[model samples]
Target: MSLCLKSITAVFLTFAGTFSAVSVAQAQGANVVTTNFNTVDEAINALGTSTYQTINTGYTETSKATFTFAVPSETLTLRYRTDNTGVALRDDTGALIARFNAGDRTASEAELMAFLRDRYAKDTEALKLKVANTPSDPVAGNPASLMSQMVSASFSNGTDVGPSPLTGGDRARGTASYNHLGISLQTGRYSGPGFSANVTSLPLSYAFALDDPRWAVKINAPLNFTTINGQDYVSGSVGVGLRMPVTENWSLTPELRVGAVRDGNSGITAVLANASLMSNYRLDLKNGYGLVFGNGLTYSKSLNSSGTSYGLSNTINKNGIELSGPFQHQLYGLPTNWQFSVVHTVVGGTPTYIDEWTDVSLSLGTIGSKNGVTWDSVRIGLTYTRANRGVEGLNINFGYEF
Candidate 1:
């Protein structure tokens, strides 16, 4: 009788162990919890008492614990049942363990389940360490330490004029404009030993126009007439740049660019080279008032086209200065962001005219004129940016970033 009882006890224990194993497997397979609340805080609160909870305590919980919570190898889905919207986690530094998304309402149940499983498998202790060392607000941290990069593409078309004689006579001239489009791709590394690079390309398009002006000529006067023809212009460039943090609120960047232009009708071609150095300073003012100052110097040189003696036989040089500033909260009842920028270019060396005749010597009476000339120009613009925090591609950009 005693032997029989022992056998029965053993059998009962084996059955109970098998049942427990199956229950654990089922729990692991489906760990997702559904809630009616749209917010993460509300969902967490709605969890029943049966759900497992881990609370952190001082001496026992180290920085590694925080890090584990912050760094997610895969996306973390936060679902708002109230609207069925969701957004993926985008914390790269493992700093934001708890983030609130007001517009994440598009994740499916299957995707959310996969995200949760991947996150659960990460090293929680390591994540905790990272999060503990990170600041509460990533943006409030050192700007120099933040990594940012951008690229843009644009197309513009405009007309150009040709040369003529000083005397009132028809000259050979052509009007041409090309639709120029370019794209740039860039990546940047921030204050902590960062780096960046970009590439740009522009495709060529062609167009032409003609102009005619009639002038009265006296009889017995020397009749000199010329025809003007328009030539299409095509140009493109690619460049790379780097930035280094000089101080807590200042940074310095240096870049180089190379480009070329071709005029098909006139057989005029040239290559362009440019080098620039820039510095930016950030200032924090009262009442959320902030200021940014930027200054830069650029040198550009144009190499003449081969086999062309009249248009540009030699290289030409141009040097310039640029200044810009941004003011925050400068006006009442308006957007807080405002910016102004100006660029001045000083041209040196003999200027090249599209028509070879413009550079040739013309003797009228006792005065003789040569073709080469020099000039300078200044361009200025202003902008206002509206703040749309936590949104991408929703703000307006009027000027170039590079």
Candidate 2:
């Protein structure tokens, strides 16, 4: 029994050695079979009437057919072809698997084959999952069937004029505004999958007063200035947004907005338009610990009339990143839900300046105090999101989502 086992082992070793030597020789001469077909179609036609051709051994001759060959039994099969003239690997299925054509240079067949083999061996399951979870359109979850509108009135007091230097000391000359009356209306739509959109508008009116008689005297002496102590500024904005689920707990949203400022005294107006893209992720925490976080980016531009070119030429660009997470009621019985966010804005193009005494003027072809300015604030508030109500426009008011 020992002698028989030894003879079998020796035979196996000899066969393995011969197979390895043949493989090495084939590997060294594989380039002799290279082709110049740019595409699978060209290669298939060049193969002529031969249904199959043998190239590398062990790989069946029937499996070596060009892309265009018809295999009645197998409905699907993967084919590989290379264009020795260029650095592209053209798959039998017409897909350009890889390209090494970097302008004027061409890659050798061996280099191209190595690249194709590496890519084919990579793990693609994660990439497939990511693509499958991405949404192609907007989706608003849950359907709220209520509609309502809200009107809010507020009072604000501030000064439009700044203090100037007096003979003996610096004094706040000019005027101050007080008891401003402002009204806002929020209209909501509650229908279709748990989705709601709100429209808000605000108009303000104020009373103005002048201070420091000396500063007024100096201005009127040099230039015949008529002090219009009071002025009105009206600002309005409209926004529309919708959210839809791409997966079980992930959603995407797109929003568009337009804002305008009209001076009641000069009847001049400035307009700004913005667009935003946002995504929300829902995290499953324990009861009363569920959190939803989101982030978004915005692009805005300003516009003004041609004749009255405010020195800044009405050019402004801004981009911001924000993050907000909502936590449920846990230890504290506080029914308040909290969210926080920070936004950094980059300002570009021309600056704007408004003189309290004279007409508004454009300066530096850019608008704002600094070329780039960032304004970030955080707030926490409670949320009352209800579903299936029959009002016209009332929904929810919360901070911006990142």
Candidate 3:
């Protein structure tokens, strides 16, 4: 069946509307105060004899361009001393919003962003509607951007770029506000268990933008080693997908995947063809926190003409929904980025089962001084998946960005 552009457009609009509920948080009339302390030692040294704390400006540069982290406001500086109470955030009316005691794990830099967002994110429908309006459309026939949205999409492209909910990873597609974001390259690896016992997946992925930054693509191969009952086996799959922003705040990604699952004991390979469609709505929350809500559908068809297929099922449909909430803050003074996410998926037609994957990561990037000053973004993270019908999986990932 051919893809329907109109239906896709409608879906995009609908998704965009769903986020209208997020309120546009307003910063009160406070003057922002920034003190440069590049490292923890520096910050610690300055506070040698006193307890001084101020709500630092929410965050700094994100992959997104010119996006406001939070409105500048006078920081509430407090002095910290041994046996001193923790800090508290308050609204204009002096209503207590949240409090963080010293040494509280929930008071980490990442959670600070969440606190700011919870306090300042939009509230009223009227304001949210106003913020949701798309900017005046760019001139017609203009050249596509080489780096604006593309940077966010390509560098942060999810590991599971294919349609199947089984392998889909992060959902950090770039914003739709502009033609392109920035241009960058990224490579990564992942190793984890699969549906059955003794099946390990080691996949390598590379992601980059096409000629136009508005279009980003990812190519990945899932290399697998399976030990069924006793015998050893090997298999892999190749997947390619592209991200296209339909608007300044929404995008579309369609992927094609092909792979074979080799069973060691049975000595049979299950060939599969999978097609997937994904959409994302980029949301900017208070502070430096960003949220992306995505949904996707994958159709898998078995190529076994002989009817009896391999251990892997032949035909099934998978539906998935994802929520990715990432935040940025200064670790000491350097930029620190982290994300938390949950993905729940359901299968239809046959081989009924459910899958849910949750993950978190912390990232740090440095800008080269001379060599074009490209940013090298590196991240390390852990994943935990709890399935209703199969063994759970755990994985670690390391990614580098150019």
Which predicted model would earn the best TM-score? 3
Task: Please provide TM-scores, in order, for all candidate models, with all chains considered together.
Answer: 0.27, 0.27, 0.45
Using lDDT, rank the candidates from best to worst. Answer: 3, 2, 1
The global C-alpha lDDT for each of the candidates, from Candidate 1 onward, is 0.24, 0.25, 0.36
Enumerate clash totals for all models, in the order shown.
Answer: 36, 30, 26
Candidate 2 Cα outliers beyond 4 Å, as residue runs: 1-232, 304-336, 340-402
Give the C-alpha miss distance for residue 257 in model 3, angstroms. Answer: 0.6
Candidate 3 per-residue lDDT, tens place, 71-161, comes to: 2221222212223334444444455555556463224333444555443332222211221221110100000101111111222233232
- Using lDDT as the yardstick, the better of models 1 and 2 is 2
Backbone clash total for model 2 is 30
